[model samples]
Target: MQKSLSSLMIALAFASATAPQAHAASNEDVVKRHFASLVAGPTPKTSELQMFLTMMPKGGDLHHHYSGAIYAEQYLEWVDKQGFCVNKTDFRINTAAGAKSASCVSGKDLVADNAAYRALLQKWSTADFYNHSSGKQLPPDQTFFDTFGYFNDVASTNGSEGLQTLKKRAIAENLSYIETIYEIAPITPDGDFDKLAAEGFDNARLNAALEALVPKLEASQAFQQGIQNYLAHLQKASAGVDDEQFTMRYQPFVLRFLPPSMVFSQMLASFKLAKTSPQIVGVNIVGQESLNVSMRDYSLHMQMFKFLKAKYPDVKMALHAGELALGVVPPEGLKFHIQEAVNVAGANRIGHGIDIAHESNALAIMKTMRERRIPVEVNLTSNEFILGVKGPAHPLDLYRKYGVPFVISTDDAGVTRHNLSNEYVLFATRYKTDYAEVKKLSYDSIRYSFLADADKKRLLQQLDSRFSKFEADIARALLPAK
Candidate 1:
């Protein structure tokens, strides 16, 4: 791992040093040169780069997760206030319904017990686990996926407050938009439907089954009621998030680990929401993609996506395909996830196209993405923590080499304990990306977002203005005096 990382670092250093410098339009160009100095050659100044990134005009976080973006600290702040407490041993929050449990510790008292409080924070996030070896750490993948369970109940307890906090943080970083996987649609099992769906992977047969079954699923009162509840939850969570400087949108998703019938039910509901809801911009499928259910039904899920997208042609889609690494799954499993996502499912955008190189037709996939302008949402921190794929071994440069559009994102900032600014720092320094491509990435975020054309134009214009002001201010304030 260390050897591969060194090679990657060397690759970045060479690119930054030898790559043509971005041309400046006029003389008051101190900011551009300053940005270059921090990222070029060996030993790039990561601290200064992070500071510069914080002031940069990032257009949007196109691959954010609602539950994972809000930090555990924020959740803890609401715990005692909401009449909740934490379990001293397991660290799960006791929701109102579970308030009567005597086994749990109050939030206030947990904080008072600094040691346990610190431990809870660790379990809730990736902090300290990387640097230290002990403390009952699960494997990285397990630890990452398990965090949602630890805080799931409290994460959504007060969606409005969480949304506000997310907004304030984004504005502070000068980001103008966020396309978050806020929540998923509800699902109910159809044992009979599952039995039929499980019988085969023949696309025609599955489509026929779905075609026969969806009307009944849609007509059912429980499914309709679930959709109503989802809309209400979204409306409440989205209250007051958008303003003159910031905008937010949702991509209701489905957990792919569920049974075929349930996955289809959820995706159906999510696509329905995407077609009609102004704030719900797209649909996505999310889960640990390496799990048995996810891997076994991988193609099935893609076919499910293919089926729904045809039904709701207006609804946009961004599937989380190929979040795998070698040895984590069988070698064969890595070969076709991203290809099927783009070709079979017709993904508008792909989140964490991490296993791109493993695909049988990797170059062909890149070519298709370039032609279609389908952007891959790259999450440096999340990838590093979850897949241990970073530095030169990461496929970011491969995507760049193929002219494929991509955007930097914070997949689960709260869990990874980093923000978009930090992601930019990682991208810039590791790839030795100069200010110009970095600037283009910022624009790409807005360009690839599943927002309406009008909202995209509005945010793009705002980003342009924000960039001009940010550069001018940095030049005036930080430019070295002659």
Candidate 2:
């Protein structure tokens, strides 16, 4: 509905610019002048900027999370459809036995009671965290991650349905592509590897351990079945999602906090899957980077990534590194994440990177990102909410100063209660960016995407057309009558 209205507005602008449609240059000049006017001051017109960015052709969301992109309301609807019951106290998916008891409520019945429904929404998401913070609630970061747990039961169940919602929403906002962290790669545990990892194996020993473990995992029925199940899941989730206008691709990730063997095995499976599946463009490692488990295994995770990259040679990674802040972890922990993610993991892209300022030799890291043309996936809303890093405190300016490329992204739009457009608004307003730089961010999204060379070129050309049309429409709307 909104998208149709926007198109109509753009058409009206086109008409207002000129009837003959021959004054393309004049219309473009008018649009550029108008945009410059909006962005002239130390403080850009934020509300107008929001409207402008909403219609801009954002190339892709490379750091998106499939489950996190889903809103809580949609999950509630699924709960009702799937006949799942919600626990009244914790807002969890209740068991059949528990559902029959007074402790649980049917989704249908819960909706009738408005208070319960609203409370459930808050608990299930970051919705009105302030209103309910008087009660027992987790910290914002904890709350954000916890939302997934509350809905994980039904999260993957309606993959195609969830994907459809995301697609419609993306198109509504004029976004052309999304490469989402769709799901985790399945794993079969390795007892031997686990023992060695806990005892702390050096790099060589770790490699040797993997050498021994690879065949064991390959021969194991459980591991092979995991791969098949993962592929089947992807097939079902992405069925009929693509068309001429928009595209969606998957990034099967491994969680950082898992056992060393589990992480390696999952990474292996995902990298292996990438070798075959065109839909699965890349792999990522994700989780709260500050957790004890995550911090301890950080180096090993990069090594695992490096090993997989060498073996597959074609698999790409956009690792979640430097996602921490000063107080989130010890100083030592901050020093090497982004560095290793780039130098060791051979990450094609970096996600979050909010802690770049605190990283040791931060200039060097930025230099590497710049030199290699590796773009950082900057998630404004996610960083602010999760790490309390925003405005001048953010490392965005540093990256810019050092010439490190970046792409604005939505790390967890549903959890953060913002869209990719809002992210652009935040970034532009915060940095006081002019229209030209803002447009570059849009183009950078496609350029840094893990899509095939052909796909990237195709999308870039589409962006060119989109920007031209958008600028013309805006020009017409801003033109004055004689």
Candidate 3:
């Protein structure tokens, strides 16, 4: 591992150094440098790769989901150990006898045994996620969302272990921090959809019914106790001396698929938790924002944030906005997500922002973001996988063109099967970025993070020193005989 890493570091050093000059001289020079780095040997270069991989810089994953970022394989492994079955039709895992389903709807058989299940999980996740679209019958979203249930059996009992697994992977990729979203508040087994659907005619009435049910959700000492249980897992996983202290902060995400009132209550409770519990950071409305209720209540949600922002001004807001496409919603809906986030909701950061081109006063919004220093967490892979926005077609270039502050992140790393390095590589190759600019992007991740000012400054200093050493080492190798 160490040897491979060193080689990778050396390869990266050579790649970064030679790439610019070679590209300028001739495109062939660029190709040659790239190839040379690829074949760079393992003894010393592998050590460099190891160093590069293990060099844990203070990272803040601004657009991360706690559940989705954890490996499906790990969860599936746990499920198998617990004796669960993979429902063949949906590809969702269930207790052995409960669902009576098979592998998936596409007719893939469930591998109940450990070894085969592990391999299948790998195929379904980071290992071959970016690669195998050809034979995979699942839609991207379905494939992505489907993993949750497969691992749900194990994850339900393995909270801290799940985070530890996530943190371990993150640290392996040189990330030091994350502010992840999790569903600590459970949606009841008894509070089934049909039961809830039957209670009300519309969202408002549904909310009233849900409010009546709030006592039930809260009454479950199980639900309330789950928060404490999850926190215990965080504390246990994070407890250490020399190891990078993985600071876990939560964003209680309200499902937008629910009626407005239930969703609103969830959001409010999340905001309240942000004030009441140090572990719970803020609130996020997750799921497809392109849905009708989501778009309809967009402004109201912003108003909701406005209320919470007033109550707990210190609480942070990093919302998913402008995750839409031009054709996804009415022309009017595109004009205002990012704007409302800033103007009404007072979001600390914005996620995606892919549809910024269609937004009215987009230029002004970018300018304000630049002036205000509101960082946009850009997940290149998710944009490609979920929304099919990428390359020059992505509004990220526009954000750059207007100098809107941003950072590259893995939105659903486990689902997208990506790491921060891959995200950086994509940005570097696609945008033709410089080392300094890439370093700036890294710095921006921590600098614009929700961490306290002092911590941010300290981490920034650490990043500067580390990047400087990396550059100095690279320059030494590249320098002509002096």
The model with the greatest lDDT is 1
Q: How much lDDT does each candidate structure score?
A: 0.88, 0.87, 0.67
TM-scores, in order shown?
Answer: 0.92, 0.93, 0.74
RMSD (CA, Å), candidate 1 to true, equals 10.3
Off by more than 4 A, model 3: 1-58, 96-139, 184-248, 476-482
Error of 1 at 248 (Å): 0.5
Instruction: Order the candidate numbers by lDDT, best to worst.
Output: 1, 2, 3
Cα TM-score of candidate 3: 0.74
Q: Which stretches of candidate 1 lie over 4 Å from their true place?
A: 1-28, 96-103, 478-482
lDDT of 2: 0.87
How far is 44's C-alpha from truth in model 1 (Å)?
0.6
Model 3: per-residue Cα lDDT at residue 449? 78
lDDT of 1 by residue, 1-482 (tens): 99999999999999988888666343236777888889878999888888899989999999999999988887777787678778888898877656635557777777778888888888888878867677577898899999999888777779899999999999999888999998767896789888986676577788888997799898899999999999998898888989998999998889999998899999999988887789999999999999999999999989888888887888899999999999999999999999999999999999999999999999999999999999999999989889999999999999999999999999999998889999999998889677788899999899889889999999999988888888888887775576
